[model samples]
Every structure is written in C-alpha cells, then in structure tokens.
Target: MSGMHAATHRRSGDPQPVPPSAGRPNARTTVTRLLCVGAHVDPAFANAVVKECIGEVADTDRFVAPSYGYDVLPVLGHALIARNRRRYRRTAILISPFVPVLLSFLGMTATIIGIALWLWATWAAVFLERLITLHTLVAHLVVPAPEGGRHGFDGRIPDHAALTQIECDRINREQDGSSGLVYYSGYRPFVGAGTWQTSSAFPILLNRANDGILPPMDDRRSPGRAEVAPFTTAEIMGYIQRRLTAVLQAEEWEGQRIEELEIARRWYRTAIGRVRPVSPKDAPLPTEQGVEHYDAAREYLCVRVGSWDQEVVASVFVNLDVRGRTLYTETHRYELRPIKAAYHEVDRLPTAISPSDVRLVAAKAVVQMAGEAIGAAVTICTFPYHLLLRALSRNRPVSPRDQNEFGAEFPARRADVLDYGARRSVREIGQAPGAHHFFQDMDVKKYGDIVQKRVSELVIDFLEERNLDTGEYRARQATILNQGIIQTGSGRIVNTGRLAVGENASA
Candidate 1:
C-alpha cells in the first residue's frame, strides 16, 4: 500500500496485495442469501455484485486491498476471540458436559442436571466477562490518553492465524460463485467495494470529411474491398493509455503528486439491462487473457485514483468500442468514502494506557456492559442453532441464462448470488460520518475531470490520425468537456455533452 505512489509508472505489475473481501455474512435462512442492511450502511441500494473480480484472492496475490475505512470485523474478532480467552475456556468446560450426555446414555438425568447448572454459571461468567471487555476496551481505545492530546490508539494489529482463518472462511462462504471467472470476461464488475459516482460517455462516428457515415460491416459481402480504416480500435486505446499516464504522472502542480494512479485493462461489468446482446451460452473467459476482443460493454480501461493516503479512492472505467463506423466510448466512476468518525476518535485517545484512564473507562463502561452482557448470553446460547443453519444452507448458484434477461437477475435471489455492491459505507457502520476535509472532495472531482478530459482528447486524436472529419466529435467534445454541476430545488443537475436533468441523473 505504501508503494501506491508508483502505481502510474508500474501500471502493468501488481502494486499491492489484492484487497481481501470481508466474508459475506451468513445466510439468514435456506432461501435468503444476503443480509438486509439498513440505509445507514448502503444508502443507494447498490446491486450487490461481487467485489473479487479475479476469483479468490490468494495470500500470494500481490495488490493492495485498500480499505475505504475502518473494518470492525478484524478488530472485533481480535478483541472477542483473542483477548477474552478466559471466558471462552470456561464456556468450553461447561459445554463439555452436554457432549457426554449426548454421546453416552449412561447417567443421562444426572448429566443433564449437571449440564444445566454448569451452563448457567458458564453463561453468566461469559456474559459478564464479555460485557466488561467491550466496555473497557471502548473506553481505553476511545478516551483521551493522559500524555498526548491525540489518542494513543494503535492501528497495528498483530498477526494471528486464527483471526486470518476466520476472516477467510467467512468471506468465501458469502462470496461463493460471485467470481468474474464464472461469467463472460467483459462482464466483470468493479472490484472495489465503494459507491458509484458520476460518469461520462462520448460516442464518435468515424467518417472522413467528404465521405459520409460508412457502415463498418458493409464490406462483409465484398471480400475484395481492402479493410482500409484510419486506425484499429486497439491503436486508439494504446494511445490513450500512453498519453493518460503521462498526463497524470506529470509534475505540473502542488498537492497533485498522486500516490496511486493505476491505469490498466479491466473487465467493466455493467447491469444486466445495460449488457449488450452477447452470447449467454458461451463459456466464461479470464479477463486478463484478452477481454478486449469481447463486446465493448464488458471491457474497459480502468483508471484508479487513490488519494488522501488511500482513504478516498475514485475509479474511472473507460470503455471504447469500435463497431462499424461508430466508436462508442464511456467512462464510469466510483468513489469510496472516508472512514467513520468513531475510528477517527482514536486521534483523541491518550498516547499510552494509564492507570487513571483505565479506571475512568471501567467506570463509564459499567452501564453499557450490563446491556451487552445479555447480548453475549444470547449469542452463546444460539451458537448451535446458527452453526446448524450454516451447515445446512447452501450458497445459491448464479444462472448463466439469467444474464440475458434485463433486470431479471437483479431480483433478490440472483442479486444475492452475483451482486457484490457495497451495502454499508464504512462511516455508517462505525456510527459516524467521515472526518474528511472539504479539500478532499474537491481533489476527488479534480482528478476525475483531469483523466476524463484527457481520454476525450485522445479519441479526437485517433480520428484526426485517420483523416476523419472531427466536426461533430469536436462539437460534442466541447460540450462534454464543459460539464458543470448546477444545483436546483430538486437536487443537483449534472450538465455534460448530454444533459442529465434528474436529481439522481449520472452519465
């Protein structure tokens, strides 16, 4: 992740560990496959598409799994499983009695009575320990330390094999069959777990000055006609990559030295409705091999921008399709919001754990601990039931036929199987808005515009090189480049080459 600054120069190579997927939460029932998160987590109700595009991320897969914000899973797991060791040990001892009763029918009544007594005591003890641990840690981790004005909370999480195993298992079970490898290479969705933002599309007709629009496929019947064209679509794409990378990596301004600006080929998975009429019966292909040959709808030149120390990430996916005499190009952007305010509270914590701070935290946590104690009991008691459910439940399979139906695969069942859109933002889960500066938002917009504009210019260049008339393209390009966000009573109107008037309107 620290090496992100070089992403632009080393575009072809892996820059960081492939991001890890937070194990999908367990299925609620045999029929239901996903958790219904409230508006707090995912305000947009994004189609929950799979985030792991390259299939399972192995430990050896080198690429940064940039976390948009704080992930409570690791912290909570470490705190409850590793720190609360004594309590779990006692719980095991208590549950041991039930094992004997179930296995051997000897002294069943006596064993049942003994089990009941031990269970109650163990449950009470675990509840108390868990409650106190949660409260105390919250206080110590949140409260201001004695020495430093800034909180002393440590971000470093020590390596623990068990924690890693738990996280991997949880993520795999929930993310089963959501891999891009299972679908057409061009249908790979955005891999980052973030929110969709603004987008832009530019379609240019490739016709020379004197010659009117020419049907690209008109020569199919006349094999004698030479395939004379200005330039192949791939050549234009190569030009854009080279030119865009140069522009981004240029040292022309301050606060513009980007840490992560990755430009590479990625399969751009669009909604089922947006997917072009590609064959559904064809076997899926690996995206890296050569998805460019697939429909333009699925392949894209993804430009990733990681700013504010990777706290804010914006991805611009550019797709270029040359069909007949028309060059169809579109750019879709996605943004990952900042970490939650609560995680930032660590800034207010003391530099070191002090006796006085500990005592104070313990005192403040007492009331909250009481309530959490009850929750702990329930969780422990229902462990068997939940375990059983997980054992019996199967992760639904994604149907290839469903891809042909517009919005058909988007229903609950299919979405649960394939949609991996982010449900909750990091800020919502942490119970606080991101502590982002106004400048950060401005920077995000600036970067997106810079890359998008460059892309448009390169397309024009491609046409120019072929001696094609650039009049229409230039006119549309000027309008598209003159994009502005106008605020209205209803909401914000984004004006581009094509005016999108709705409050929710995006390119």
Candidate 2:
C-alpha cells in the first residue's frame, strides 16, 4: 500500500513523505492482490500483479477471479498467539501435580514458577476478555449489517477508493487532522439504490496497466470544473471517449466487424438533475452558484462498449488538471475495475475464528504433561498442532479462484474486493438501454459550442475526430470557446449549474 501511494505521489504533487515500498518504480514486480489478510494491493499496484498472473491464465485457460470480504488472518493470528501462550499454563498444570515427587530434585524454583503460571493464567483470562471485546467492536464496524452501505446505497466511497490521488490526499489528511472540503450537493446517482456490475473488463485492465500497456499520455492537463476554467460537460465526455478508444485499441481482438467507429452519445449512460437538499456536511460546496440542493442527483456517465463485450472498463475521474506551479498541478486519477463472478461468493462468518479455544487449551495441557513424563518425545504432539494452524490458513487460498463464474448478480457493495467492479456493473446491466442519455441528451456529432477557451483546441481536436462536418464543427467550436452552448440536439444542452464548486464526492 505504501508503495502504491508513493509511486503516484511521485507522479503528482504530494506533500506527505510516504516511503515507497520495496521495488519503487518497479512496483509491478511486488504486487500481491491481497498482501496480507486485511491489506489489499490497490489496483494501481495490482495491475502489474495481474499482468504477471495473466500469462499464467493463458497457460491454464482459467480466469483469476478476485474475491472480497473481511480477512480472517489478523484475528486468526491473535488467536494463535493466545493459544501459544497456553503452553505456559500447561507447564504449571502438569508440574504442580508432581510437586511431592519433584521437591526432592528442584525445590522452591519449581514451586515458584508454578505459582507464577497460575497467576498468569488468571490475568490472561482478563486479557482474553479484552481481546474479545476489541474484536467484537471492530466486527460491528466492518460488518455491513449495521453500517451505511449494506444495501450498496450507503453512498460512501469504496474502501479501494485509495487507488487515486483524491483518495490519498483527501483520506490520508482526514486521518492526520485537517478537514477536507465540505460538500452540500445532494447529487446521489443510485438514490440508496443498488447498481449493477460496473466494469466487466477489469482483468484485462489490470493485465494491461501492470504490463505498462496503457494509452500513451498525450495530454495530461485537461481543463476541469472551476470558475475561471469553466469546462463544459461535452469536453469531459470527450476525454472519457478518448480513454475508452485507447483501451479498446490496445486490446488483442479477433473481430473485424467494428475496428474503428466514432463513440457517440449512444455509448454513454448519464443522469443529472435537481433533487432534494443535502447539507454541506453531506454535500460539498458547489463551485457554481444558483445550485440549491446538495441532494440533487449529479452527473453520471457509464461508457458502454458494444453490448455484452467482456472488456475492462476504466474511470479517469479527474478533480482538477491545472498546470499549477507549472501553470497548476492537476490531480489525474484513474480507477480500473474488472468484472468477475467471485464477488457473489459472500463470506458469512469470520473463518479465522474457527480455532477452538477449548481445544487449544486442552492441547497445551496435554503437551506439558507429556513433555514432563516423556521428555523430548512431546515434539510429536506439538508438531501436529503447528501443522493445524498452517492448515487452517493454507486450506483457504487467498489468490484469485481457478474456475470463475462470470456475470453474477450485483451486490451493490461499495467495498473493494474481488469481483466487486463486475458485480456493480452486472447488477445495473441486463439489456442495453436506449440511445445514451448523457447529462443532457447532447448530440455528440452535432458539435455544441465550446465553453472553455483554454480548452478550445482540445474541443476542436475532439470534434474533428467524431463524425462531424467541417462547417458545423468549426461553428460549434467558435461558439463553445466563448462559453456558449449551441443548440445541437432537439434540445439545447442545459447546464443546470446545480453542481457545487468543489470536486470531492458528497459526504
């Protein structure tokens, strides 16, 4: 995780001095999907790991599906440690009985140690209770049963949200002391509603990104939502289109049916409108004024490739791309999620809690007696218990599953785990819906007026690529550069301007 955080911070501007994990720029080499029980390798780092895994996939002809849930190892380790200490109790219990026999040989030392072990056991009982209380409290926090996101409509950012800059800067700072920008806009997309599998093409995305097989960085400083740099919605969609084009282009495909085609409004799914009031505590302050309710549903554009295409999907969610310092430093973040089936495999109980407390106690008692009565021969019993602990964890593989089921029902969980990306999108997708209803049903080919002059070239470049005539394209570009919206579709692209001025998600 530190490696993932440091690698990106080096790319952007981060004040925090996070030590990069071993391998530095070669983070791809050190990728472990789930490094430990609870610690997850951010997709940024896991992408490289996936690339290495993909070669194995081809050889095995099996999909490495990601899995998610509470890791059982941490508490399991705690249990094991607690169990190991019982050996001391076993020593006291077995030796005390032989006091009449051993007093001739060892005297008071043996008696004193026995007394100490007994005292320790009583104290350990209290310690064990404390550990249980701690475990129970932490469980309530992690278990979605009593949380905000159980039904997937919790609206909280997914745990893996740390894969991006906003995640690192915002969340990490939130951890230290400072407060992040407050949002008041109620621009909820799902409305406490469950969404479908989001990105089916995650495996492919990770495979490529890890292999450094990504779209060449042609442009980094894209204009964003701000007062001076008022970027229009079309421009944002254009970037998404461009990124998608690059992803589709890099894929190794056998089809010749559609090699290249202008991505139009039909390829996107979007919803933007006014809703109810959402306080700043819930909604961040809107950058643009006249936007009243934070509860209003905001912009959401799910770019769709050809229907049912099992391809990786990516969201290059940008906060600001200013050339600050160098014009202004912009935060360019990307989240790539693959679709997998294992996300549906819900882990109901904590598997680590399987070790029996009574059994552990009993085993320790037997070991001490056997050791005293039979000397080193007690190794035979201790060896088996060591193997048992290993068996408990080893029996449950942490790596991706071998035989994966694709297109599982979406759980709408915000948790980032194996197959989560796909689960979200799958739940939302079944039959492809009508023509892409972008933020305002804007016609991409119609070439609307550009709103940002600094980004005019970008808009023009975007328009030129789409299927647009020279006359219509030039006229729209001129109008748009001056901050005007052209009547491109049956209805003009209306900027409800309801969005708050900030870039952070709602509280």
Candidate 3:
C-alpha cells in the first residue's frame, strides 16, 4: 500500500498475490490484533515453538491450550481458536471456513452485477441506433454520440465503507451472533469510516469480481521491485548477533554478565512510494495500491555490568533492516521507578476434563440463552456456498503454512497483496489535521545522525588502536559504514557518509 508500510517479511521481488493467513508471512498479515509482541521469546525458543506448531503439539506446561487450527497461533492461551470455541487454560476457538468464503461469494456477486449492467448498456445503445433512421437530418436528436455513455444500471456506486463494514460484521461475528470475534486480545477489528474491508484468506479469490474501485496490484505490474537478498533469515540473524557482540567487546563490556539476549522478528508496514507503468502504452499514471510490509529483526541485549555492592544494568535495542543493508543501534537511558509488580496466574482446568466436552457445554449454554440459534441457522443454511468453495478451490489450505525457511530463500510468501485495501484505508482514515504529535519525522532523522556518528567514532577508535596502515584503516572504515542504511522513530540509524571520524562529520 502507498499509505501503509509493512517492514516485516523479506520479499523475493515477485509481485504475486498471497493467500492470506493470520499466522504466516508477516509482510502481508494485518497487525490490528497486535498488542505488543512479548519480550520473552528468544529466536531459538520461537523457532522451537514454530516447529511444534508444524508437527504434533500436545498440552504441556507452556502450551496449556492447543486447538485444532491450521497453525498454532498464540491466542490469549485460554482457548483453541480454529474449529470451535472451547475453554482450556485460556479459551480459544478455531473458525470454520464458512465465513471467509461467504465474503468471497458476495464479492463475486457484486462483480457479476456490475458486468451485467455494462453488457446491458452496450446492447441497448445498439438497439437505440437502429431505431433512429439514418435517412433523417434530425437523427442527432434521437441518437446521441457514442461518447455519451449510458449511465450504469443502478448508477450509484456501492459505498466501499458500507460494503467493508457488512463483510467484516459477517466474518468476525461471534458464536452468540454478535458482530465481532469472541477473543479478548483487547483490540477489535472494525471497518472505520470510508475504509476498505477485505478477507485476506484468499488473495484474488474475493477480488476476482470486484467493481471498478478495486485496482488490482497484480494487474498493475508495479515497478522498482528489488531482487531477493542473498542472506537467509538465520544467516542474517547470526551476523547481527556477531556484530553486536564485537561492538560490545570493544566498548569494554567483556566482563558484564549477559542477563538476557533475545532475538525477535517483526514486520512493519511499508509504503511503496510510487508505482509507474511498464511503458508509455501501459498505465498513464502511477498506481497506489494496498499495504505492503518489510521485515526487521530486533535483538534485545540486557546486561548486568556492575557487581554486588553497586549494581548497574542496561538494555539496548539493535534493529537490523536487512533489506536496506542498514543497522540501527538504539541506546536507552533509564530512570528507576519504585512500584510494586503485579503477577497474573491463569487458572488451569484439570487434565481429565476434556476440552471438547467443555465446548459442548458452552454451546448448550448459549442455546439456552435463545439468541445463539439464529446465528447458527444463518451459518448452517449457507452450507451450499461453503461446499461450492471447497469443491472449486484447488488450494483450500487446511492449516496455516510454516513461514520458517532456510538457506538462500529467506523471506517466504508474497509481500504483495492487491492495493485495494491500502487505497481504501488511506482515503477513509488518514491522520486528521492537527490531531496531535509525539516526535516528528525531523526529530527522528536528527537522532539517526547522532547514532551514526557514535558508531563511526567507535569503529575509528578501534582501528586507531589496532596500528593498521592508516590508509587501509580509512578505506575499511568507509566499507564498514557503507554496508547498509538509515531511518527514524525513538531510534535512527544514519550512514557515516564521511571517513573523518573524531569530528562530527557524519553526525
């Protein structure tokens, strides 16, 4: 999307439309459910958990609740989220294929209607031409010029917002027939005013019959796509760790006790600036599409540097933007807060209490409440549509695919989805004028310069002590600084554009 930038999944330069799954491909997944990624997951631990999801997962101490879903998505840890809502240690539910496919059918229906209208107009025009005799000089009054197109049938365009809202209401609505999913992740998905609503599960599946508004990214052939990076995710993670360790050693932190060193990957949305046409004969103007995401790896290192009598601890965030070939190291300053910490222990049910039995009881309870039957009837009556989708779908995936890949093929899955959603979100929900401000863009840029300057200083200082040939040292310094790139936020990474280190040349 031109408006939303997702810096999550590393891409392979292919503009393929991805089949949507909440679990896989960070670049394409919506982050509305994201509260904050828990800090406890180390890369090794996270990988182990992913492996478990791909294989046989049992109820264990860590995963108290496991559900019958495609992949083991982390929910509130109370329920199994895929098939039916059941209470475990944390209650979760697995959604059936019914809702998402229904949304697709509705989209197709709209398209068919739109096409029918156009065809009718075309035939009507021909009939009108025949009725108007060519023999008369007053033919102009009867037959209008072909340029004046017949207005489309039911001329008013469908509101993208309303359509989106209706679809969203249908898709995530609860088992109780209420309009929203039952899970309590604190954030609820909704169709904001003028926003586009979409089912991400099947990329082009729902979009096949969209009205004129959905300008598909696949059809556009957007430009300036970069080739896949040579380094794999594992390789990149390793390199970043090595660099951080070396940097820490040079800064005289060798004796410090490493309390926590965790590696996590997050993909943030990235706005692909402008997509131009392939040739003059192609699109006349640049196309703005929906959201795209880029991947960034963050390594958190917390160290206890000072000993017994007087203890000092520090944590720094190392953000690696592998695509940009830029590394950002953000150092944080802390002030101590004297507040009591609160802990929550989620109650676990007995192992003998079957999860399926619990789910049945909950449903029975809902039925007793009266409102549940209506929602169930609406869903069950649409049985034929689900059957149709199943029969037609060649790739109806039963589970979320594993995003973990090795070797040369780094980022898995298509970073591209059709730009319709992006265009819709921006038009409807752009930041209001004079809303508020935290840190401005300029503030971030300045901070990046400072970090780059410090990095340059460290490298230069190390080289100076090494007694390497001064000429070679300067040359190496340039290469070291030039490897990757810059950006903003609470942290910024800037390239030391010059080799003159001691002074604030790069800063």
Clash statistics: count for each candidate: 28, 44, 40
lDDT of model 2 at residue 328? 13
* TM-score, ranked from best to worst: 1, 3, 2
Estimate the overall C-alpha local distance difference test score of candidate 2: 0.28
TM-score of every model versus the real structure: 0.53, 0.22, 0.22
| Residue 134 displacement (Å), model 3 | 80
- In model 2, which runs have C-alpha deviations exceeding 4 angstroms? 1-114, 117-281, 288-315, 319-357, 361-461, 465-507
lDDT accuracy of residue 194 in candidate 2: 23
lDDT of 3: 0.25
Shift in Å, residue 45, candidate 3: 18
Tens digit of lDDT per residue, candidate 2, span 65-169?
111111111222222222333344445444444443444466778667655554444444434433442243233212233223222111111123222544333
Off by over 4 Å in 1: 1-157, 163-188, 210-228, 251-259, 268-297, 374-435, 484-507
Give the number of colliding residue pairs in candidate 1.
28
Each prediction's RMSD over C-alphas, in Å, is 12.9, 24.1, 29.7
lDDT value, residue 294 of candidate 3: 35
Ordered by lDDT, highest first, the candidates read 1, 2, 3
Model 3 spans with C-alpha error above 4 angstroms: 1-52, 55-371, 394-454, 462-507
